[model samples]
Target: MSRERKREGALYLCNQRQRGEEGKASGKEDEREGETRTD
Candidate 1:
């Protein structure tokens, strides 16, 4: 593989990992919010 493509692939992977973490955090927050509203 070319150097640039390899670099881009690494960046893409990093972004995907970050997005996954963010999604998990948001999901937790949503569950908390839902509970508060129901109370």
Candidate 2:
């Protein structure tokens, strides 16, 4: 049971990190688009 719980925790942390990276990437893309629109 403990091992399974540890695995689950690791997976959750991995997912959270991936989500954060994706959010940052999308935010940068949005900024680029906004700049292009203004020009």
Candidate 3:
């Protein structure tokens, strides 16, 4: 992936972590976001 997508993905990880939620559900959500981002 390009630097921008990596940066944005990192930002999303940080944002999700900041929300104080973790584990399987968030993982699935992140995957969905990544798919959406690709679209």
**Of the pair 1 and 3, which is ahead by TM-score?**
1
TM-scores, one per candidate: 0.64, 0.66, 0.47
Error of 1 at 31 (Å): 11
Please say which candidate is ahead in lDDT: 1 or 3. Answer: 1
For residues 1-39, write the lDDT of model 3, one tens digit per residue. Answer: 699999999999899787756545467877788899999
In candidate 3, stretches whose alpha carbon ends up further than 4 angstroms from where it belongs are 21-39
Q: Rank candidates by TM-score, best first.
A: 2, 1, 3
lDDT at position 22, candidate 3: 58
Model 3, residue 19: C-alpha shift (Å): 0.5
Q: Which stretches of candidate 1 lie over 4 Å from their true place?
A: 28-39
State candidate 1's TM-score.
0.64
lDDT of 1 by residue, 1-39 (tens): 699999999999999999878878777876788899999
The whole-model lDDT of each prediction reads: 0.89, 0.90, 0.81
Ranking by lDDT: 2, 1, 3
Winner on lDDT between 1 and 2 is 2
